[model samples]
Target: MSFDIGNPSYGLVFWTLIAFLLLLVLLRKFAWKPIIQALNERETSIENALASAEKAKEEMARLSNENEQLLKQARVERDTILKEAKELKDQIVTDAKVQAQTEGAKLIEQAKKEIDDQKKRAMAEVKNQVSSLAIDIARTVLQKEFEDNKKQEALVADLLKDVKLN
Candidate 1:
């Protein structure tokens, strides 16, 4: 090993400097724009994903609130329907009671009318029987008084004519 510090290789040094400069020029021209564009696009995409996540969270919260409100409204509607049904039931019971009372009154009136009709018919029958008894007694007394048949016949005709004229 000899340390010849004084000798310098100028050609080799010049060639090395040229190769380094060419490599720098090639990377700057062909690769720098595309790589930098890729990095920027990645950053933009991450920002878009974060924004979408926040929007989804807000929308879900709003939808949950709406669901709760709808449930409350349904409960109110159900209560209203139940109240109306109870009122209807009460009204129906009252109507039934009134109808029963009216029917009872009608039946009582009909019974009274039947009793009055029966009483009138009974009175008429009694009067007819009394008249029949009187006629029978008169006929028996006339038969006893007249022994002769021809004389009795003449007396009956004359009495009947007199009664008709009066």
Candidate 2:
């Protein structure tokens, strides 16, 4: 721990310099170039990986937008289909109502025609019955009143002339 103001020994300084030079030479020859090259390659690989990641991110974003557009289109198509279906249902309902109305009208017309035919037939039947009854009554009266031929002929001619005048 004594202080000295003198130059150190040549051998010690020379050995120390030789050791430092050897260490520098060994590091330069064996470690520096490969370490720098490996560092550069690692940097390049990292840069390439980052670029690829950025490209993938862009592609994913584009795909996501496309998916959203497709979803919107699907929704629109479904809405259109639903609207068309409703319209078709409405048309079917309207057609059914029209058909029902036409059928009802046809049925009513047929019933009316049948009733008219029945009415005409009933009137004809009544007329036939009345004519037959009247003829029978007339025949019975004629039989009761007409025993003499000459008297019957004279009375029959007078009745016929009276009926013609009325």
**Which candidate tops TM-score?**
2
lDDT value for candidate 2? 0.94
The TM-score of candidate 2 is: 0.82
- What lDDT, from 0 to 1, does candidate 1 have? 0.87
Clashing pairs in 2: none
Where in model 1 is the C-alpha error above 4 Å?
1-33, 127-166
Model 1: per-residue Cα lDDT over 1-166, one tens digit each = 4445587577766998999889888988888878888889989999899999889989999998999999999999999999999999999999999999999999999999999999988988888898888889878887786878888889989888889653
Residue ranges of candidate 2 with Cα displaced over 4 Å:
1-10, 148-154, 157-166
Using Cα atoms with residue i matched to residue i, what is each candidate's TM-score against the true structure? Answer: 0.56, 0.82
Prediction 1 TM-score vs. true: 0.56
